[model samples]
Target: MTTCNYAAPPFDHPQADVILRSADRVEFRVFKLFLSLASPFFETLFGLPQAPDGATDQETKDGLAVIVMSEDSKTLDSFFRFCYPSTLADDPSLENLTDGLSLLAAARKYSLDLIEKKVCQALANPKVLEMEPIRYFAIARNARLAHETITAARYTLRQPLIPAQFSEIELITASELLVLLTYHKNCSIAVQPLTKNLKWLTDHYGGCDACIWLFGPYYKGSCGCGQVADNRFSPWGIHPVTWWATYMQEISELLMDRPSGDTVRTAADRTIQQVRSMGCSVCSSTVKENMTEFSNLLALKVDEAVSMIQLEMDF
Candidate 1:
């Protein structure tokens, strides 16, 4: 074998100079210092690819070509700085409420804090509620703030005062009712007002139809009927006993008949069966553990404080 003295190209070669220059330009455009540092090695390893000879300015700016381009901090910052407010101001598509809602969703999804704030501000405007789905989505997503949103929506809905033929009450949904109930349970004097209202309503109207629907006829009949009365009918012509018996009988037969007993027993049995089927062992265990840990922590804190006070010699 003949020994050949072939030297690798120098850094100052014309090709190497072109590569370094291209890399520098790329780093400048991208405005990423890390990319700038690594550019020399990268350019040496891979030669700069040729751009299309006659590509238009718009084509390059639009970045629609097959070549892979990196979006560095500078480009992104510039793009957003101009594009965001411009899009908000001049975009005809965003004039549609649905588009605004979509933008809100996108802002939320991407964790774009400023964008989300802007979207929320837009939504706060009265004009935004013209989109029903957006209004519903906002209320549904932010359940904690739903009361405020509902109040705002009600105000908006009433403005220009166009009355519809059919009127629907903007009452809380069943889930929201449960949330309100749980919220109330933590407060003192909760049961007093509820009990008082229940009694007042019962005395005045002879029981609520909605309550009857929820708890069944047994609750309705048993609540107020005199001992000697075999049947109970409200002043509103609702036969509590008959309705309860019929509804219970229908349901019982459909899902395995239960023996005639106290409503509480029947309800308890149904609940137990449902809970058992749910396989909530983890939840039960976690709840038990949490309760134990909380009690222990409280006891430990109390003991620690007592010990500290005793050590202070003010006993």
Candidate 2:
């Protein structure tokens, strides 16, 4: 039998006090990693000069501070472990579940690619898997964002599943499923079921842009890549995997019949009156609806429109 040599903390951990006192400082690095991975928030932080390979300890420390001071505590701690592996087993005074989750949330919210990858490795322990939902939520949430590399890493870290007991499979929720699907974009096994579920949503809700964008290719017998694949529909000029949210918005507008000049005027008047009556903010912005909600409303309107048109046809 092959055995694994995992890293563990020593009996007399010398840096325990420094690790605890400066725990918040440790999160700064994690924040930097998160900012680097997410595109929208990337520009907020300024760049730092790289430390020379043969630079003295003081030179390296000074160089790091330029970029490090702007980062938060949660981010700092996450980055610390990656730079110094021995610090992994340091027993910090983790006050509660919230503290741990807050750190994990920062990782996910900022899309800290490297930290997420490492955390997924720690989560592979069976003991960790059996923890409370709060703990599992953190792991699942991050795992959903870490991309395919994390999934591949996890296979080595944990035991394989038994195919015969497929029914006994532990299933993730819709939100969780979305995360997993987003992380492992190329996994056909995972993508197929999600596609099927989205198809059902389309059949029932018809005008839901989110569902349409999510599973449009599959339903239309094309792929998002514009390739004519088996049982997939190509979303022309749309990148299905990345711009799913935007695609749903487009589909919703189409279902709403593009709201003509007359329709827009009527909708605007109604919206103004409704907002005034509620005493809320002015109707400065256009009303936006999710694909699912829009689809439902569209189906009803289509039914009514068809009924009205039938009388004209009959006459």
Candidate 3:
């Protein structure tokens, strides 16, 4: 119920022939040509024959035709600002997502696809995804932005504790909420295997001195981290009991750390951080490669899971 007492400055085009009046009666002078060229709806509307009834028609100071709009003054101002030659907002990066939603509504009303896309681009910036995924996700879903929807979904997985109800719940259907909750559960389950096994690292870990020294004592094989000629031999040695135990604890903590990225990427990042801090160059390189490969597989699993679910919004 907040009303603006201050009038917004009109985005005046000196040669404009059309006046747009907002619901609050603020007037903006703009070029009919600009509107016509930007939107086919406007073009067709302006092309129609008009009555010469001056009593029913509202005229501006310079005798331009006035079109009253249902949108509020602020929305009309923002909408026209985007249509004009000037920049759309004082700081688009700092603008609220709700403001962008308003602009989208106005642009849609006029069938300004280009302006609608621009508003979507502005709203999908990195700052918005990081700062407000819930709101962004709600808008993105409704807008039919598939990539943005997925990005926002991934960002939500970064939270250790997600809410069942939030500010924009009215905009999100029960099915979408279920998809998000399932996505989180799937991501957590996706990386759970990392805690039990890490022998895959030895496949790519060359016989570096540090690797041999570190892994020799714990190798499931007795060849001192050497090439076992047997075809059945796994080049990668299994994680020792103690290392696996620590890894179990570490991976568990990282999953609860509200780690960002998909399950695979999150696991890979956390594992690399843990491996590098151990001060073992061999361990770091080995685990890095192994975790990356594992993450790829996990990514595939997520895709497979996603294919079975419906998260798309028709409109």
Candidate 4:
């Protein structure tokens, strides 16, 4: 409490019973009652037997006991805000993922159950989790936040595999990384069968006449454009429309790289071009609507399949 360089506001109440000093020498004059109520750590600390006359060599300033904390001023400021009554805002903005993780660590250290819960909720926010999911996953897994870890891991599937060098990799163990990789691999495997079966595409409707002419063996007449060379084996046990086959091929590759519904939702340029190039004017005129409908169903099916692949987290 030497020369009190900084006193965080809201916590700087003049009538505060104790002064919690940060590692950087900033002081937060907070009420012991609030801290004790919110944290068992503080309760136990204050319950300790006082020195004779309560005057042992514990640091003091202005007649209030000074408790030095290892956290910096900013972190303690956020922690105390949560410990305070509902008069203050319930949630404080943690500037970045690093700050969120720092607050989570501090909350856990102090055994502040409510604050830890709030921090976990904030960390799980989509805006926060989607920005850098792998980093969030590493940090959250290291912190042992099972929900946040799983949420972040799922978000990771929307992007390619984890890069070789990310800053937060040090926070997680090899086993943690392996679990996520396995989950991604499982999701990828799950979606492969989806693309291999054209029955889902044709189940609801008769084959498109344009597709049959341009892609299948029903080539009765041509609209001038030559038929696409669709020699690839069809999962439908019959030749799939060249355009549909191409679309499936591209999306299946995309799903393997990023095993998520999002991968198939955005139709590939190659598939669209292939559709437009079809000899059937009907297929070209209706490609937009048809692809939208098909891709939506495909994306939904991909999500359903991925949802079944459980991410095994060792919480």
Candidate 5:
């Protein structure tokens, strides 16, 4: 039960009736009535009768109540700054996402759900999750921000995060962490079959005689049927077949490197670029259409696999 005669922060209103002191002894002289109006939680707290002998309070001077908070002075100032717009000349400084999240936690601790939601919105903007997705995943999951949780989880999937690297595992629920791991496993398994249908482009869509001129006659001579090549024994050009082979290999590599819908699309795009380099009208046009279809199918499969984890998104 120690108390200090500390001066209030610079923004403290002169007519404030309550003093909030952080663990480090910094003081914020904020108004009780304004806080109560903004949050029913504070109103209910203020409605309670004073503790006998002011047991929970550090000290009350000049008829103003002094309530000591467990948060550090920085967090208290940040939290109060958002609650009191008059104290700030600029928009609430929410550049530090972790601090914004911590302020939300403090708000929720005291049932300031209104402010809690505002903080959630603030955290949703900017590069918070991108900065540290695994860490953001842990925080969002704990805060029960379902959309943010899934967004961070998606980013986490792309990272090389190890369980040992996460310092805040205790903040993440076992079930939630299991769900994320399950999502990674399912996506890996789902993308295993993500190979382009080589038969469809090569076999089914065998090139016509004129097609070989554009593709370069990869085969030596025309068959008795007046066709330059059939995909089974002869391809009009090496590029289409080579492209599919390279694409399949890329798919396998991507499956290992986090084969999300977006990553697979990039792989498909690269494959199509290589296919175009062959300058074969038949190969370029056919493969472009087929690759688009394949990418869509693979993306759908990945999304379905993610759905199995049931970590539904909020937006």
Candidate 6:
């Protein structure tokens, strides 16, 4: 039998009843009562009768039964910290998705529901979710976490369709990837209407004397500002300037690549410049404020559209 070796602080308490030996050989001296309270798996484990063949003898260390855990020291340490009441003040930090998933796996394995809940909350942290949403989606989907999978998949829409490669990519299957891709495609389809249809804006431009020509041929309201001769169909079928067409086209293409409100919000720099530079004098002066308002509206609508799209999770 291998001799017991090391014990880290907090896990090295002298009054503890059991020694949980991590696969990496670090021993944690903890109370069986805490383990029993935290995990049904451990509770049933401790309630079992010892083997008559003296098999338990080889696992003993310093008069305490040594429970060898499959998890390594790092995972064991984090897992135990959640189980122990004393460590509740400083909860484990799941700074990254990988570490969060690892701790979650151990918590789930031991049937620690409360610990699993905590790990899930950490996984949903905005920093953690936005770090590498594709990787998070793959890992969460593989683990069959429905909420995490959907949340991560939605976050991925903020990124380009060709996701950055990561180690966790191997965790998901082709079918799962197809689901995400399909969801992305559906979101693009949903958002394209925002660019094509102008009815959603209603009559916001109704009273605007400077940009009335943008409604694409149905403008009887007023157009003191001369229409750019190129007069193309604007929202509400009024013929606006060519720049408006170009602006919407660019926004459409951008949303096709990344269908998210954040994309719409950050994507209008060049287009805004075009609108200002290409519009008539009156339109140019007010374009900045108007465009800002419009872009904000577009972002809100984009988010609303994307929210309606649900990622299908089979696992």
State how far residue 57 of model 6 sits from its true place (Å).
Answer: 4.0
Between candidates 4 and 6, the TM-score winner: 4
Per-residue lDDT of 144-234 in model 1, one digit per residue for the tens?
3443343333332212222222111233354543432232222212222321122333553355553343222244343332122222223
- lDDT order, best first, reads 6, 4, 5, 3, 2, 1
| Alpha carbon lDDT at 108, candidate 1 | 43
| Model 1 stretches astray by more than 4 angstroms | 1-96, 130-140, 143-153, 156-174, 177-315
| Candidate 2 local lDDT, residue 74 | 49
Report the lDDT tens digits of candidate 5 across residue range 1-315: 665545445446687788877878876777777678767767897788877773665468666787778888777777776676564423366766668766877898877766776676667664766566777777777777777777778776555424446665778767777777776766566555444333333443465443342233332342111232334323433443445555666676776657567666778888788777766555665657777876776666655555555453332
Candidate 4 residue-wise lDDT, 152-254, digit = tens: 8888988887555788898888987899999998989988987766666666446655245424334444333343455443543455556666677788788
lDDT of 2: 0.35
> Could you tell me the C-alpha RMSD of candidate 1 in Å?
23.3
Model 6 clashing residue pairs (backbone): 214-240, 215-237, 215-238, 215-239, 216-237, 216-238, 216-239, 217-238, 217-239
Summarize candidate 2's per-residue lDDT along 1-315 as a digit string, tens digits: 232221133311333211121222331222343234342234344344445667734222213332323444544454344434443334233343444445555555545555555555454444444333223433444355333323322331121221122211243345543442333232223223322234444555455354443333443454332212323322332334322333334333432332212232334345434434543221112122333343444344433332222111100
Candidate 4 structure lDDT: 0.75
Q: What C-alpha lDDT does candidate 6 achieve relative to the native structure?
A: 0.76
* Alpha carbon lDDT at 54, candidate 2: 73
For residues 1-315, what per-residue lDDT tens digits would candidate 3 score against the true structure?
433233345456566687777788766777777678778888998898876676555554566787878888778776666666555334234267877878788888888877777777778887787777777888777666777787777777666547645566777788887777776666666544443343443433444333443333444343222222222222344333233234335545666434333544666677668667765545545667655664665455444443444444444
Task: Provide the TM-score for each candidate, comma-separated.
Answer: 0.24, 0.25, 0.62, 0.78, 0.62, 0.75
Greater TM-score among 1 and 3 belongs to 3
Q: Once superposed on the true structure, which residue ranges of model 3 sit more than 4 Å away at CA? A: 1-10, 23-26, 72-74, 81-94, 200-251, 254-259, 262-315
**Residue ranges of candidate 4 with Cα displaced over 4 Å:** 1-9, 50-56, 204-227, 231-247, 266-292
RMSD (Cα, Å) for all candidates, in order, is: 23.3, 22.7, 7.4, 4.5, 7.7, 5.3
lDDT of 3: 0.61
lDDT of each: 0.32, 0.35, 0.61, 0.75, 0.63, 0.76
